[model samples]
Target: MNPFYFVFGRSANMVLILIFFFCPVSPSYGYDPLDPKGNITIKWDLLQSNSDTNDVKVSLLNFQLYRHIEQPGWKLGWEWLGKEVIWSIQGAEATEQGNCSRFKGGQLPHCCENKPLIVDLLPGAPYNIQTSNCCKGGVLSSMIQDPTKYAAVFQMNIRAGGAADSDFDMPQNFSLGVPGYTCAKPVQVAPSKYSSDGGRRWTQALGTWNVTCIYSQYQASTSPKCCVSLSAFYNDSIVHCPKCSCSCQGLPGSKCVKFGETPSLLQQVKDPNQEPPSIVRCTQHMCPIRVHWHVKQSYKEYWRVKITVNNLNILKNYSGWNLVALHPNLKSLTQVFSFNYHPLNQYGHINDSGMFWGVEYYNDMLLQEGEVGNVQSEMLLHKDEGIFSFREGWVFPRRILFNGDECVMPPPDDYPRLPKNTARAASFTLSIIFSPLFMLLIIFAC
Candidate 1:
């Protein structure tokens, strides 16, 4: 009834329902109490985050402000501003190689890198992360000294001698995902303790952690809206997805074709020009799907592909038709994350080529002859990854509206879907600096 519903509106993400047992990997490390000394440095090398090498001022300060802090989730735009972030606190130091990324202010997932996160004892403190759940003690301390420059200062409450009478404790809120977004599983905590100096010095404990996933509610702007019930976008009336070739549940006839049903005969465009070496303008030489496409619209940290109905044959009231994109020469294809309609399976592969298909319906009204009907979808693409989101979809100029009479591919000065192409993965090197105290130290705060 609303414009958004007509176009693509926010749809519930397919979570909870599709959940299977997410087996937690056993942790190799645990908590051990250390002398509440001058300054203790814990290298929290976080994963799936980016640092600003571009913004020299902020990037430089980040080193000073968050010393020894690994896997910092703060973004260039001061992203972690008001978001609630949680860390699994046990006394165990992360394996030199196996550190997981913290949640990226509701943008990313928490997981081990292409490299698995390995946590073990902290040098002399080889305490196994003992707690069955993580960080159950209570809120220790936070460093929200300046909201303007830091969001990573949110929470870190693991202290010694808490109500649990256990040496280790996680913040009161042991899990991530608050309100609109929530964790799909129950959160647990553990503690590790090692006593030296005859129990005077001890490796108080925090618990071992169970890896889990978070579910985020739909935000401000969702895109390229489509019927995303089962990885198949539906126009319903057109009922032409899965192509009736791979598999289908619909009936047979003009409605359902025998296997290998060819589309209504139309002169197929010449073989699509070889995949362009780099992202470029769509040309007449390019396929009609490419020419009729527009910017992969940017929507809050993500992007979506938008296409205009160039075919007048799609007369108004047309329903149940799937939009297809084929890239004959696509070489590398993998998804960094799992989404509903944009999975690798949805993009069928045969030999070296592949085709991505989605169903779209035009306003439920006739796409009056020649009157271009623009259809947007709910397929959200990560921003930095948007330009390369599709191995072969046409790249367009962002911002400008689609003018039916445009002659050039990206019009003129329009840039690729992603406005800026900075690395989302920031790099950090450990340069242990000595403090005036003359005692060894850990750094994570200014």
Candidate 2:
């Protein structure tokens, strides 16, 4: 009896000590100060979702908070805090699921069942929290859960080498409904017409052709040492003939008379012994002729023409003067008078001494009875008297005058003798006889 009582006493003492050490004295509660051992309580705000329906059976669903340290430049490093204490409201509709417990290894972490988990934060420390759905084949899987509901809150340490908290804000929300619906407008065009000839057309109306009359200066014939008429010839017509006291024929006239036909010849025939049938010949006459002169007085004329062309069709590039011959009728009766443009140059200059005088009738209609040997005259001039005068039935030859060249008849015998000095002596006598006539004109004018 004594041994049993001692053993029982010892067991009772041991039991009391064990109860004092192992049993939770006040519901296993612990305290963590809200501040970092300071006088002020930590201020926090819900950064993500502030309200929830509490429909999920997972911990930390629809949770978020941000803790900010009032002090500047205060940094907090990541450190594990003990498991959180959970509480349930009375009279709430509780599901059959057990109360959410702190997750151990191999168990889906406590936040895995929630859409998002709340993170415990230190003041002024960078942190992040994440959550994922662990259960398969549920409505949560099919529907896109709100990322704000699973976001964690934390304060970022405003210090060097500190990353910003990732789970602080909510992700952009999108609807799971049929992908949301947009379109552009069409451009406008105008109509146009097509041409059959592939060319632009224009309207037509009446137009007038303007005409002008160009007058040529008076021209002298090519015959030598004879007084020729000055006249303007137009379109093969002798329009104007100046009247003067000179031995000049209009179109055609005989330079000599037949010995038997003239009255003087009849008188001479009556006195048969006196040089029987001697003829009284008329003086040589110069017929007016037409000629063209270039405006510059140069044999070569440079014509500069400026054409304002809106449209032009040219087959080939061509440049030069186009000379047209004057009609023979005009050339016959018109006289071409010229003046020297250069004194020393006898070739191109116009000089009174180098005048051209000759008759150029095309048919006997304008010629005297004996003027032309025949009805038709194709030859232009006859070689005679050093003058190379044109004769009856003589034809005009086409000649081109080049620069610095003379248009004289071919020379006779190359060293042909000048007419005898008697002719020159006779010319001097005539000049002497004519000197008084000029003196009288000067005296009359005075």
Candidate 3:
């Protein structure tokens, strides 16, 4: 025997297997294998200018399939290549107006900062300041969910007095100021086209450039936000989410409070001003969100499943939240209750994926930690007798995603297993034992 195997024995192999399944793995940044072509592109279109200033229409297009900008939405910033100042802006505004003491005449520039941070206007912005697709408070949905809401646009006029021969250089050091994203330098592309009067007339930009950005979960520098638990009807075993599935207690941004441990902590959680994704009820898994999957019932032709989502973080409410499950049985789904269901057939002809969310004005907004901190739904799927089996964790979902982030699932060994003396096993043995007698009786009757 090899010395390594002789010394470690079979127990050592089990330890290695657990490590392979539970331990965190380092992931590469800037590319996602699942969504390889997904990216957010910033398009800057310089419109035809007859005056001294340059008019530009900047649009942020979300080309990603599932990722979206959530509340307290995106902040876009860039450094000017030249001494360019914003003369006027519509649909968006600069966060700060820097010192403009050098210029002493005429209408003052809207902003004099060399590197101004821009943010989208709210829905109720004045009519004079509004433009098409201008104000959504920087919230851009995923292209796959809603293509019409996947882009944000604004128009600005730049006064570059120091430019030579009316030439404008591309800006440098572009940033979304949101974590997990890094942008590439702007590349000149063919001019973008525009349609006016309901597509009757066409217009084109004088010049166009694009900046592409990609997201990396590791670069976000945050722990996972969600986890999963599982249960079944035939077994008493309930598999809770793994301990410390997201982060360990007492770590930064993992603060929690036990019942009556800190009375003030509850008050702090109730405070509207507190920061989010922390200040949760204490639990073994320090995740903000928990998704529970329960095999509710089994019938001759159909199986029922119940899904519940819990919000542990008291400081935040999830708006437009959604849950996705990958299971072989989802293709035969017959009915769903309470929540809205949609098939996400990202891969053609493979229908093993489905997405679920809450109904409008009812449970759409998952409330903070309280009596109403969760949303649940029931699903009925037609059982496929050809391959359907409850053994070896076949009934549970293969993967679960909450708000586009995959949740951590329990190990396969931890799933509920059928008892040796269960009703099904006993029936199988009885049938085998009586088969000969039953066959003889059938021959006599024939």
Candidate 4:
């Protein structure tokens, strides 16, 4: 019996060795099958403004899961495992303004109060799930703090055949929690007359101000009384008078009165000789008139006469004198003549007692080397003087004053010819010429 037992044992051992060698078991671990009837329970804390109140509604969108596989060197593989899960917590009721409610189909039902969704996973595969409300295109996604980290907690369960596998545990539960972005209702404060400052402050009367009489100084019998007097009158309308039998209103003999007449409007003045002033030619009599100097761009100097004249004179002599130095853009700079005597002298020179007028040139005078533009004293009289005069709506340059140097006169062809006046010949003359050197001095100083 011992020999037969030994033979049987040896045969059995040989058969086992053959099986091990021929089968060549792969280097792998086996996972027990999952229970088909098992359910995964998931719970998440509802997001709230201040505390863990389940009154706020929150939801997840674009939910997804990934599985980590060892065979492929622990690479991450995406799985649409969210479709397998069902929601458990619908959300809380909406009572406050902009709050979400469970009665509304779109509202999120409360957690634990609502059913949770189950996610399915592949057997033996390590998996993770994530959810995002970003695709919902609302304030929820942007307002959530650290949404990416919060989304990493969704879990998944797998059913492999019928048995449960210890290796097939559910992924950690996560959430893209609801964001507290509801705006609070704005409260408005109305303006109050009793505020600390003199101005009104906001009160229950909205933004409108309640007008109240703020007594000021009195001007006439109808003017409002002074604040002190008004205060006395407000307290007591009647008071005893010291001298007269008739009682003086509140605080006897007080200059202040309850009301007074309104101030009168200012009166407007008019002048009879207010004709539009006209431009007149600089006559020989007006030769020594006062001149004011100014500078211009491109190294040029300008001169003008300052005077005020009646508007009628300006209209009558519109074409006689050329208001040269005034800039076209600076109309205010134009000189006007007047009949009244001016206290200030022209360039510090006293003027003769008479109704004086001024004439100006239209263009700036250019300066050359060794040329002095300003004259300390008036120039000597000359024949055929190049004078600018206005007449019958026409401007005439009677003569061109030329010095020894190339006078740089305006091109003869460019000169406009008056219908009834002939172009005067250029003449040599001495006059107070404007110099461009002065312009350079002004430019450098500035």
Name the best candidate (by TM-score).
3
Residue-pair clashes per candidate, as listed?
A: 58, 24, 0, 58
Please report, in order, the local distance difference test score of every candidate based on alpha carbons: 0.25, 0.22, 0.84, 0.21
lDDT of 4 by residue, 336-423 (tens): 3221111212223322111111222421121111123222111111111233222221121211111100011222333332243323
Model 1 C-alpha lDDT per residue in residues 407-434, reported as the tens digit of each score: 2223222222222323432221112233
Off by over 4 Å in 3: 1-26, 161-165, 261-277, 421-446
Q: Comparing 1 and 2 by lDDT, which wins?
A: 1
Backbone clash tally (model 4): 58
User: Quick one: how many clashes does candidate 2 have?
Assistant: 24
Residues 1-446 of candidate 2 have per-residue lDDT tens digits of 69999999999999999999998454212111111111111112221221221111112122101111111111111111222112221111112223344434563322211122222322333222212321111111000112332322222111111132322221121111111100011111221222446567632211111111111111111222112111111112221212221234333542335333444333432421121221213322221111222111111211111101010101111011011111122122222322111111122332111111112222202121232311211112112333332222111222211111112222122211223468889999999999999999999999
Candidate 1, position 322, lDDT:
26
TM-score of every candidate relative to the true structure: 0.19, 0.13, 0.85, 0.13
lDDT of 2: 0.22
How many angstroms is residue 156 displaced in model 2 relative to the true structure, after the best TM-score fit? 99
TM-score: the better of candidates 1 and 3: 3
Looking at model 4, report the run of 10 residues with the lowest lDDT sum: 225-234
